[model samples]
Target: MPRSRLVFWLFFAPVLLWLLLLIVLPHLDLLTMSFRGENDYGEMGWTLQNYRNFFTEPVYWLTFVRTALYALITTFITFLLAMPVAFYISKLARSRVRGALMILLLLPFWVSELVRVYGWMILLRESGVLNFVMLKLGLIDKPVEMLYNDAAMIMGLVYTSMLFMIVPLVSVMESLDDSLIEAAHDLGAGKIAIWRTIILPHCKPGITSGAIVVFMLALGNYLTPNLMGGKNSLWFTEQIYNQFIASFNWNQGSAFGFLLLALSSLIIWAGLKLTGQRLGEVAS
Candidate 1:
């Protein structure tokens, strides 16, 4: 064998093995499990009941739709919040300030996601820090219930997903030429026009990539929605968890998992199509 071919295999083999073992195999197992169910004789056989249940059951389908909608909303909100920060860090900030700001963005992630969600709980709970401060400042008559709601869940999702959006945006935006914006401004283009004509067009790939990632994370998230939204979360992942753990129905869980995977893939495809970007372009 050639030396280059040997080196290629040496590098590629581990990645190929990792994907096969960790991703491809597990998904295949789940796919098989999703099709297994009891027949009239009470023997497990190939069946579509698991997938059918998702559509026939109102709770199941409704939760799935709700989760997708929330994920989309979370992605859009994260994009809006990340864009300005990415612009500042990439285009405007000095080296020292940029580094400091990046560190701040990354600092939360150094802690486990569970810890960060609990931190939000500490701030948002009725007897937590925010209410105490508000009471002290005479801002409210009593401690307001802030935790365990849709708004709280959305906030937690956005908080966790922000860094994902910002990193991609900043990465792509850094490559944008400042001279383009300068030339546009020099030609009497407004700030909005500069952003519309230059910055946004330049950042389409990053935006699409970030949005896809954020949507997937938010859609599949269990901890933040479960903890922050409490009993009222109603997230599809919670349903999947219930099916697997709480109900001890692995087949149902597998079906739900595949449904989620399908939904993520479909949305990502649609987003790329809408933005006139390909998966390869976004990934690059």
Candidate 2:
């Protein structure tokens, strides 16, 4: 057999088996559990009641709708902000400067998410640094309550998800030929026209792919929303967590997990369509 085939068998086969044992099998088990109904001692009785609760429960659907809207808005905002940063770093920054800047962009991932979220908690609190600074600067007489709200959750989401959006966009943008933009300029096209007619078309895949990744993550995140979203913002993942760990309702938790999985699939599918993926690309 070929060396490549030998390597695949040696390396990839074990990983494939591990995935089957761990991820795929567990996910399948969850699917089975989702079809069951709640029972005494937190056990499942095979029925469709768990799935029925998702649609019929007003609170469940409300949380779902709210989470979806937040995710969509977060994804769009992250893309809009990250695009210029990625394009600039790829096209304009010097090689050494790019390394430093990229590190700055990715530096937060070095810390735990809990730590980062708590850091935001300190910053956005009434007696926090922002309030003190604004007051000292005579911008405001009193501290604004920036903590414990949807706006705070959005800030946290944007901060955490920015790098995911930036990296993919940069990966595609760095490969772009600068001469094409120059050629457009040479043809007497204005800056806006060149960006709209040329650069936008070339970077569509990166934009779509990055936004999808960010959106899925933001939608499913429990930490940021629960910590920053406060009592007012009812994120759906918190419900899943409560059902599984707090209340020990495994059936309901599984149903919630399946709903999240379905939502993620829909968003990813839409992204693939918008990005114009080929058949082979989708398959592989």
Candidate 3:
């Protein structure tokens, strides 16, 4: 047994080491880099200026808060919409059609999110498909500006994150016993009562997990907001990208990245605490 345990650890050790080297080491490097950096003349020194700049800059803080709020709104909307769809997939779908429907639901995953977002762009932009359709319908003589707005940003986020929310919800819901729901119904529980009392409590882990994933992705997103929201959106991750790529302020960029990491960790912890859950249980 001791020899077997040693062999097992030896096998696992390289994988752990690889993870530490690639992921953990890079993060540590980023933390160090955020504190210490070079000047234009290539002189290096440690400084707190990155954090100072982020806090002191109004646009940086505003974009960060805006991104957080946008992600929150998207997560909430995804939960509201995904629950019923997941339930339908789990409870209402027949075996004959279920496979087909599941495939159809997941077909979008095969398409790139960038492509999907661009499709939305074409549809929402002025003088684009939507405007053309409205013009033909005589709804208005002029095309309304639809893109580069908060609504556009939220729509893009929801579209991007919906699959993440739906898949986990469906996975968790599919395993739930129909008899439990029947028992609730037999106990004179209405649809709302059954949903509130029986369904919500059971799927808390999936909801929590899905929320963390979607929220984290959205909060750190630079692409979707930039493409869909245009100049008006001003997402926080974009600010970090600007710092690193445009301004060549690697220290400030690293600081923003670490700030995002800290915020994401806090959100994940709060979600776990709120749901009183473990992902292992949910997956099992």
Candidate 4:
């Protein structure tokens, strides 16, 4: 082989091996496990029983649907909150201020995600800092039970996922031409009209990228929902975890894992179709 070809192979071989060893092979094993089933005597073999259980079990399918909906809600809320912040950092702030804001945004990410979730637990629990502050300010008569609830779970999801949304939005929005906004203003276009016609259209790729990421993360999250929402969370990932660890049913866990993979793929495909974006463009 030529030197260039040999060099190419040298660099690509590790990546190819990593993908096969870490991703493709494990997924193939899981795919097999998902389709297989065990007899009453505990003998495992090929069957569709695992998949069927997901549909037949109200606890399983209902939690799946609830998790999907919550994930969607988290993605939307993250986008709404991140958009303004990204806009300030990328478009409105001075260079020094932008740097400072970016540092602030990045600070939380330096810590482990598990630690961040625990921090939220400390702040949102009934006797936590937030309730103490509220009591001190005389805003409430007593400490509110803020933890182990849907609101707390959602807040944790949004807090953890917001940076994913903000980074992409800032990347796209920063590239937007300031001249276009000035021109629109000169033409007497209203702020909302300018935003609708100019800003959003230009940022569709970023929006799609960010939403896909945040949605997938929220959907697959177990720790935040489990720790913050307690037993009532019932997130599908928690179900998968229980099946694999607590119940020692790898087949069911594998099936649920594949279902989540399918869900993410379907949602992403639908979003790309609705937005008229090609996968290649979004990937780039």
Candidate 5:
């Protein structure tokens, strides 16, 4: 073989193999399992029963919709919070200050996500740190029940997903020309007008990419909802976990998994259509 061809294969072969073996093969197996149902003989038989179950069962369908809505909300919240931080780091701050800010943002992630969720639990649980401090300050007569609720779950989701949104926003915003903003200002364009016309359009790709990633993460997150919201967290992922682990229903779990895959893919496609951005451009 030619030297160039040899080098190309050497670099790309492992990636190709990894994609095929780990991602493609497992998903293919899951796809098959999702369509299979148990027969009278207790053997797997091809059928649409698994998918039908999802539609007919009110709890399952409701949980799925609720999970999607929460994920959407989390993505929006992350985007709102990240934009200003990204703007400051990329456009306003000095280089040293930007670096320090980035380090501070990233430092917490060095700890395991589970550890971070537990840290939230420690602070928010009744009789925990927050309540202790508040009580000591005479703010409340009793400890507040802060954990095991929707608010706590949303807090964890936002905290964990912020970096995903911030990185992409910073990447796109850093490339924006300062001269354009100055020119807009001189032309009597206000901050809102400049943001809508210039900054948002320029950052469309990054916004789409980040929102897609964060939405998917929030949708599929099992640990944060389970740990933070306790038993009341009616997340779709928890249903999947229950099917696979608690109920030992692999076929049902696989069906739920594929539904999540479809949900993420459909939402991403719709977002790209609405924003007039191509998948390749956003991915890059």
Candidate 6:
């Protein structure tokens, strides 16, 4: 074989193997499991009952819709928060300041996600630091319960998902020409006009990519919603977890997982369509 061909195989082999073994094969297994069920004779056979249950059951479908909505909201919120920070680091800050700001953003991720969620709990719980400070400052009559609710869950989701949104935005925004902004300003464009016409158009790909990733992460997240929202967290992933871990219903869990995969894909497709972004461009 040619040297170049051999070198190409050497580099490609690991990635191919990793995709086949870790992604494709596992998904295939789940697909099969999702269609399998036991009949009245107690014999396992192919059936659509697992998928059907998701629709026939109100709790299952309602939770699925609710999770999707929350994930979308979290993605939008994360984008809103990350955009200004990314713009500062990419366009406004000096190199030294940018590096320091990036480090600050990344510092929390050095800890495990579980640890970070617990940190939020420490800050947000009724008897936690936030309440103590509020009470001391006479800001409240009593310790306000801040944890175990949708707002808390959304906060935790945004915190965890913020870095993903910022990194992509920063990467794309760094390539934007400062001259474009200066020229627009010289032509009497205001801040909002500059952002609307120049910056936003330039960052479309990054925004689409980051939004897709954040949405998927928020959709599939178990720890943040489970811990922060507590018993009230009616997330779809929680239902999937209950099916697999608590009830030992792998078929049902697999079905739920596939439904989640479908939901994410559909939402992302719709978003890209609405934004006039092709997946290829976003991926690049």
RMSD of each: 1.9, 2.8, 2.2, 1.7, 1.9, 2.0
For every model shown, the clashing-pair count is 0, 0, 0, 0, 0, 0
lDDT per prediction? 0.93, 0.88, 0.87, 0.92, 0.93, 0.93
For candidate 5, lDDT tens digit of each residue in 18-39? 9999999999999999999998
In model 1, the clashing pairs are none
lDDT of 6 by residue, 1-284 (tens): 45688789999999999999999999999889999998889999999999899999999999999999999999999999999999999999999999999999889877889999999999999999999999999999999999999999999999998888999999999999999999999999999999999999999889989999899899989999999996866999899999999999999999999999888889899989989988888877
Model 1 lDDT tens row, 1-284: 45688899999999999999999999999999999988899999999999999999999999999999999999999999999999999999998999999999999977899999999999999999999999999999999999999999999999998898999999999999889999999999999999999999999889989998899899989999999986856999999999999999999999999999999999999999899888887777
TM per candidate: 0.94, 0.91, 0.92, 0.94, 0.93, 0.93
Q: Residue-wise lDDT of candidate 4 within 1-284, one digit each (tens)? A: 45688899999999999999999999999999999988888897899999999999898999999999999999999999998899889999999999899989999978898999999888988999999999999999988989999988999999998998998899999999999999999999999999899999999999998998899899989888999986777899988999999999999999999999999899989998989988888777
lDDT score at residue 90, model 2, on the 0-100 scale = 93
Ranking by TM-score: 4, 1, 5, 6, 3, 2
* Winning candidate number (TM-score): 4
Model 2, 1-284: lDDT tens per residue?
Answer: 45777877999889999999999999999999899875676665788888788889999989999999999999988988998999889999999999999999898988888999999998889999899999999999999999898889998998888888899889889888999999999999998998899888888777877787798889989899988888979898999999999999898999999999999888888778867784355332
Error at 86, model 6, angstroms:
1.2
For model 2, name the residue pairs that clash.
Answer: none
Local error of candidate 6 at 256, Å? 0.6
TM-score of 2: 0.91
In model 3, the runs with Cα more than 4 Å from the true position are 1-10, 37-43, 279-284
lDDT of 4: 0.92
Ten-residue stretch with the least lDDT total in model 5: 1-10
Task: Output the better candidate (2/4) by lDDT.
Answer: 4
Candidate achieving higher TM-score, 2 or 3: 3
